[model samples]
Target: MESVRTTTTRPAAWLMLGIVLVALNLRPSMAAVGPLLSAIRSDIPLSFSLASLLTMLPVTAMGLAMFFGLGISRRLGERRTVLLSLLVIGLASLSRLFLDSAPPLIASAVLAGIGIALIQALMPALIKSHFPDHVALCMGLYVTSIMGGAALAASLAPLVLLHGGSWREGLALWSALALFAAMAWQMQGAGSSPVAAAKAGRESFFSNARAWWLALFFGLGTASYTCVLAWLAPYCMEQGFSEQHAGLVLGFLTAMEVVAGLAVPAIANRSRDRRGVLGGLLVLIIAGFCGLILSPHHLGLLWPCLLGLGIGGLFPMSLIVSLDHLDDPQRAGGLTAFVQGIGYLIAGLSPLLAGFIRDRSGSFEGAWWSLTAVMALMLLMVLRFDPKHYARHIR
Candidate 1:
């Protein structure tokens, strides 16, 4: 198999900047909706079950779309795929401007999800191929930009409502970011040939034990994240925080995530194995989930900080570990997509499950405890993620 060739004079700086810009658009289309859920529900007259579906459908789309990412990239090339993703995201986001009800809104969210799935599934491979010597650092920046977008949207969505703007406007505003990213990406010039395409025929991703483990690990971690993103604001609001304040709290959590997302990968890069760092972060998430369950209102600030720092670090580390499992960029891309595809499908259930738990229990305690259990599972799973085990799977 041929390796991905790179030009010695490739514009690394501009490429990194483009990656950051594209990454920044990945999460806002979904993250922004959570904080504004109440307002949207009030206007659209949606049930809790239906509202939960608003979050679930997109994530499900993301998960399902992952399976097709490789095929799409093969047909369109990576650069064109990304550009198409940005345009899809922009159009989907703008669709919300005219949408006033549930079906259309959900459709827009699903479209945005498809775009997000394609870009995210391909990015790890792009980083591995382009920044071979600095995969961890590049993944760190990419993940940080993703978290930063989530934070910005989560923080600002409620503010848009607080200023008397409609939910449609609040949701539509993020399209501008997508548009800007599209423009920046276009300026970066032509796409590279699909680097990971050749390896697709060598190994069946489903047959690899390590792939299954990584997918499960990724799914469990994402479930925790999805629950938090979908419910934390409403949970806080139930505890007497105003909508704006709850959004800010969720925003604060993602902001801490951005900080941890950038720092953890950089620190973990110094080590050959990341189990120790992964272990410590899982502990923090456990503590945070426990706090949120037991006394959410008492130490409100601390719980999210812990959650943010822990999960923030875990997100990139999970992807980085998967990328490190194989030397071939194409193989790594296939593995990463499989991980995200299965993981996100699992994660798509979280918001709905949390909503079910919330509706049944009349509180989010069950939801929080469920996440705590997931964190424990994540800790146990990471123990098996020794890099040596994955080294054997590399073709």
Candidate 2:
């Protein structure tokens, strides 16, 4: 066994900026659809479950694609895989401009999901490879960009749709972001080798247990966040808030996430071991979920605000943990794919189940309570994980 560090030289500032720029476009296509669900549902004649499916299918697809994405990355290389995914996402997002029916819309969403899966799976590895010393700082910025994109899309999608006179234009706006990401990635390191990267990843990732725990944390944490992302608007509506107000609340919640996204990973990384930090985050999420279930209406922005912050921290911490636990940066990619593949499948069920619970119980409260239960399970899992290192061996 040997350790290799690739030769690369650039100012730290520019590398961070470029990574964030690429990260910014990663989730806009997915985030934009949630805020506009009501309008899409109203215009398209979708059943409640079907409308939720439009949202869940892409997330589900992202997860499913991730299951085999590592093998794909092994063959294609991480950089090319990411670039290819961005191109596919860009094209799919743009195609939504012409879709008036559910099937076409669903297809476009699935395409975007596939692209997102590729990008999400590869990013931590890219960050580790490119910014070995600044994993925490760079991950903070990367997560910031991710939540920033989601917040921007959530806040602005309504305005875009209003001004463009259609939801199609709003949804298609992500295509431009995707194009920019593709160009930035191309210009930065066009000659980087992917086959070497993939080979390197395989040797590093397959022998680790900590990688699996981190992946579980990433998956479960992300699942919780996506559950909220997918349902926040509808929950608001059910509570009697106007669509515009609900959208804004959701936007504000996402904006609050930036605080956690940047701060938690930095804080967690400071300690050699992250279990205490992980425990703290689980507590915050518990508190936030409780807020949503017990006081969402009364506290107004308080519950979502707290949940958003907790979620923000959770996302970056999970990603940073993946990098930290692995001795090799290359392993970060495959580990990421596995985590996302499993996590998104868990998350993909959230919106659908929330809808089912809503229909079954005639209320969204039951859904919130259910989310609280998931968070509790996630907390217990994090407890068994020794965050400073990988599990000694797979038991």
Winning model by TM-score: 1
Point out where model 1 deviates above 4 Å.
Answer: 1-7, 194-198, 201-203
> What is the TM-score (0 to 1) of candidate 2?
0.90
* TM-score of every prediction relative to native: 0.96, 0.90
lDDT for each residue of candidate 1 in 116-137, tens digit (9 for 90 to 100): 9999878887788788899999
Residue 198, model 1: Cα distance from true site in angstroms:
4.2
Task: Please report the candidate that would top lDDT against the real structure.
Answer: 1
RMSD of 1: 2.0
